[model samples]
Target: MANPVELTILIEKIKAKTAVVGVIGLGYVGLPLAVEFCKAGFRCIGFDIDEKKVNLLKEGKSYIKHIDEARIKTSLPLFTPTSDFSRLTEADCIIICVPTPLGRHHEPDLSYVLNTTRTIAQYISKGKLVVLESTTYPGTTDEEMKPILEAGGSGGLRAGEDFYLAFSPEREDPNNKDFSTSTIPKVVGGLTPQCLLAAQTLYDYIVVRTIPVSSTKVAEATKLLENIYRAVNIALVNELKVLFDKMGIDIWEVIEAAKTKPFGYQPFYPGPGLGGHCIPIDPFYLEWKAREYEVSTKFINLAGEVNTSMPQYVIQKTIDALSENGKSIKGAKVLILGMSYKKDLDDTRESPSLKLFDILQKKGAVVDYNDPYLPEMPKTRKYSFKKTSVALTAENLSSYDCVLISTDHSAYDPVFIASNSRLVVDTRNLIKDSHKYKGKIIKA
Candidate 1:
């Protein structure tokens, strides 16, 4: 397998754009990646166990809003999604974009990454480049993944000399209008210099910016730190919001004023709670991993705890609102508007809406939600409310005793909801036009 002639043949194929680029775990991160590589003129093969996604993608349709349908359609022939691991040998380059969800005890679960590496190592040959794009704690790439590949293969071939291995963390922000897969600067760190150069060659062909780091741990920590900054700041604002709410002050307005200072205050607004993939989950992975070093990430751990309590807090407020109107939450029909974590995106991974729904149900309220982007939710830790769609009409809003704006999806007209709803608990300041709403809003 380490034959130089075989390696040279694979190199020629890659250089000639005839090499296949196989991507495992074709979800939000992987699909866009396959398209990017295909657009860069390589034949890309995507692997996902979900046959539904494979069928949908093969038909030139995109499930993600940020991804252009036509762009995907054009590259559909070059990009293929399959469920078989035996087909891994078809690719000259492999990228792992699988999920890295937290375990029961909040540990960094490298199971999916390990499973994928073991699968790929079986079919791996010389000159193939493997890049892990899944987010994890530091040292996962060189320390964890490198050995799995070398150990699994039949021949006792070394990592860098026989095959290239690297870690390039995915910086994808779903529903974000500003950044996309290709536009975001990709950070690459490999086990060896040749590994780095090979990975750079692949990414440079597709991504506009590629940053090479000293080692895999550096690249791993870079992603964690980026998300940690967000988690801590959001926690600070959430605390500020709680304090300011007690004083009958609006935190959004305060952020607006502070943002004008232009020097230090980078404004981060409070909401129902922390949601989305990176902010809500990535910080905890580091917190769990830091225990290995016997170092307590107190700030990160506290922020996670504080943010986790926010959904219950919002529910308590809504319950209070109901009680103030001489109504009990037990029989109340509460409609939550916006299910996606952010505005105008179909991604609902790690959305705060899950906790909100569970909390509302625990209070015995009849829970329902409205979101054009989401018709159903994939089950995740401790919460499993199959998303049932309801209209955001005048009558529907009027029926619910309380309407909570869980997520501020862009398409929702706040004026419409406020006018129709009996009582609205606005968490995201969706109904910021107080003059328009005539002060019927409870700013969370």
Candidate 2:
């Protein structure tokens, strides 16, 4: 049981907006969260190992595409961006929002999360609240984090007794115009009942709603379930897309028609493949953990296979479309549109667009890319491109043998692209209903 006196003091600080909230890993998730805490009247300190991100935040310059520079500038008064871990001592509440990426073998590589936890443990004190917002397996909080934290803290500082610990998964949808961090309902679970209450009170100041669950493991599982649901459904649709293509049925049209039902149907569109930080990677964490229980995650494994194969599927469609025009891929001039995973954002982690780009180039096709978000291709772990974004103009569009729409950004004018391009391989169905470019389009 937690000391009632200590819990009360922490709750009081959160209610009065006087808590110093320390947020770690200032990326897509952490940056917005830190901003929300500051906006909610709490003094926030953001920590990141990356010096460039810290400098940018300190200067009120936004590196992320969706996070506005003006918003960062306005929040600078209440938000302190730093790389120093020693400043953790000033915080009443600390939130870890680091990356939980997969390893080379598709296993959960928790190095980032674990390292962040170790640092927090070194400076953690009694009466302080610690929360993890990183996505991972169920056992991560209780099995991995709790032990490390307990060992690092002072003898008197006990979880749920002297101090508090919780897991609150981050639900950050980058570039989503409708729901900001404050509006998204937060899910929090703790090592104990008192830990849960303290975390709930802290989030109540920022988010519109706070859902308290049984334990930290449940909270971790909740995040995995949310992402796995997306991965499985996306795979289902991607598989359907292949079958529908052979039957000459437009999967996009079928989806629009199917979505009219007022019950039990949520539409998940088919894309080049799974992308982003969560959908492409989070499911695998559960899959790896399931092996410990001597069970198989068939759906997850199958989804991985089907979704992973989509880039190749799109490539084949491109080759077929080119062959129809009496052109071989060996000498074809191909232009890839959209480098980022989704539209209106600049994040490209696990983006299938890169895979498509690599495949196209390897097959002897001359490949170029144009993304308003990314002017030049950044070096990735598996692939590196010495290419700059091509100018999207009438002459430029007409110069390509095939224009492949990998990401359906809102900035693209479907009619203009279809009218200008010699052949369009639209994997995203961006130009699906356009009557003007119907003749030049091939729905991949």
Candidate 3:
């Protein structure tokens, strides 16, 4: 229902890079997006409820490890970071990059998304374009947000008429060298055709490619499928890992051999557990949504079960290693190598290392951790550990009864750790030369 005149005006503003782009939630997803928008020559305003983050941006500092301070300093002239919701009126395009976490019962928790929508509704105006970049289930943009924006907000301006709405899931991979925010392709879906055009034109300036989909629901489902595919495949390898461990088969060597086939397969390695913001949580959004239609996601549910039980499996491996050394599980000093989920990054969101730490301490093992990326354990939604990273040294490694490698960081010297430690429980298969160590290493 939007007039061609209004749509043309929005497109022109984006083409000329004159539009004021606003991004809500200045976390890993939102901050990079705002920086990319600024790099595309648009004036970007970043909003966050946390004043600490806003102050850090104002000081030209970068909190995330992968995003350099040089990038933040360079974009300081065009970027504005603040906690003011009233400034929403000044933006021609608004993007929501808030968190969509799972509830205690694994239900899709849309509180952050819904609260952001209500706030946007208060200040949105005619001819403004609003796109959601937060990952959620299908029908969230049209079914949840459209009704709120159309109900007496912005003087009852109708969606696709006086205003525009769309969904483009945020694809942010922190510390990924091959893809940056601007280089990644964006899949955008709109509530209406005009809405799609408006949103796509705005994103075309920042991203390498814009893939326009049919509806917001399709875009929403696209994100879920991407993550659920990863969750399922990882679970498959993890299940196989346990089975192979029983048969004395090396899953790592099997993956190396299987990946020799160039055409038919993609390699997904198993680890302590699923980590990061997306894979562990995003699949459940679709699983939760499926329940409304009387459908059961048994495959996804079983994958979740397998991935969730990995930490316990790692714990049992530690116990077995300790027992073989004639040491009791309780009162044994165990050192954990690397706290981050993956190698070479400081991001600890939903990291399996945290679960390992918690389980080790509860089992009466004196646990300590070391990570070159993190000096201290970061506070997360579910964890609060008053512990700092322990230094990894020859003497320090030799002092511990057992050393468990939870994360395979590039900085770790597998030979040094294997040689120094009395017992090494290798969860990530870091110590490949176990033959030379002579029973020093045990693959978990």
Tens-digit lDDT track of model 2 for 225-290 = 999999999999999999998998889999999999999999999999989999999989999999
**Candidate 1 — which residues are off by over 4 angstroms?**
1-13, 435-439
Worst-scoring 10-residue span by lDDT in model 2? 432-441
- Model 3: residues with Cα > 4 Å off, grouped in runs: none
Considering summed lDDT, which 10 consecutive residues are worst modelled in model 3? 148-157
> What lDDT score goes with residue 246 in model 1?
93
- Report lDDT (Cα) of residue 212, candidate 3: 99
Model 1's TM-score against the true structure: 0.95
Compared with the true structure, all predictions reach lDDT values of: 0.85, 0.92, 0.92
Candidate 2 wrong stretches, greater than 4 Å: 434-439
Return the candidate ranking by TM-score, descending.
3, 2, 1
Per-residue C-alpha lDDT of model 1 across residues 210-251, encoded as one tens digit per residue: 999988788899999998898889989998988998998889
Q: Estimate each model's TM-score.
A: 0.95, 0.97, 0.98
Error of 1 at 127 (Å): 1.7
lDDT of 3 by residue, 207-253 (tens): 99999999999999999999999999999999999999899999999
Per-residue lDDT, model 1, residue 182, is 86
